[model samples]
Target: MDMRTPLGRVRGLGSTNDGVKHWWMQRLTGMALIPLTLWFVYSAVQMSEASHAEFTVWVGTQGNPVLLILLIICMFHHGQLGLQVVVEDYIPSESTKMTLLIAIKFAAIVFGTSAVFAVLRLTVGSS
Candidate 1:
């Protein structure tokens, strides 16, 4: 009494409903990283001679804060996805795997959120 469609069963794509979503997220984050990383590197290179005050002022600019936030988010998201794949693949125990995945996700969120908050502080005001 297989519930899967004939083709699904044949292709070994049975009802693991999250497969497509996981794959898509990985690719999407990877794509987002390209431009973000390029911009970051370019900005860093161009700012190589900048003093601390200049950098802080630059961070307070209009779009730089948003770009920094997005960069932090996409970087962490991409890293979390890759680490999840590794844990899923290499970790043997189901309990351990689930624990590691949850920890990875939690850490990513915490770190990413704090980073965005820090950027906001830099961009908004000195206090």
Candidate 2:
């Protein structure tokens, strides 16, 4: 029951069935960023003249830490997804593409974790 075309057979190209999930996640994260980004900008402006202790206290306040963590997660995840699409589309070498994708994911996790940890420390230490 071979249905693949000659060219497809030659190239061994086939669907991995993962594109839809990736696409949906990219769109969802992008949509989520809009409000989160606005909130972050508004908060930044509001806290522009805040002292260090005041800023820490603000972070420790109700909902602020949670919002900050969500912002970090969505920001890093969205960036990683966009970068993966770009890398997959443009990069011709499989090895290079795989290496880059791995690096991107790893960096995103490390940086995102550090950002969240910093926020948690601020919230906890301030309390």
Candidate 3:
């Protein structure tokens, strides 16, 4: 038996089919960020008083560059997913929603790439 309410039937709204995947990705990235953020805070506090060269040297240390890149990727992706949900939930206009989603994705890519490149450059230069 068809169980959709009259309003649901009229609007023709239904599952997007990818909501579970989206939810899983968001949760996984959030879980990954927990330890990453803790490490970042601890490192920041440890190096709070270090000189510029010392900071660069730390960034170049074994596994530090990789962790930093992972941090950048996860942070930007998490933020993009969050903003996408807000836009989709609050914005009523389809065109505006699509535009904002594109912008969010673009900004995430640009900023994330820039962060990763900066870390790589520092790592290379420190050697």
RMSD (CA, Å), candidate 1 to true, equals: 3.7
Q: Order the candidates by TM-score, highest first — what do you get?
A: 3, 2, 1
Task: Please write out the lDDT profile of model 2 over residues 29-86, one tens digit for every residue.
Answer: 9999999999999999989999998888889888999999999999999999899889
Deviating ranges (above 4 Å) for candidate 3: 1-17, 125-127
Model 1 has how many clashing residue pairs? 0
Off by over 4 Å in 1: 1-17, 46-51
How many clashing residue pairs are found in candidate 3? Answer: 0
10 residues in a row with least lDDT, candidate 3: 9-18
Q: Candidate 1 lDDT, tens digit per residue, 30-93?
A: 9999999999999999789999889888787778888889999999999998998898789989
Ranking 1 against 3 by TM-score, winner: 3
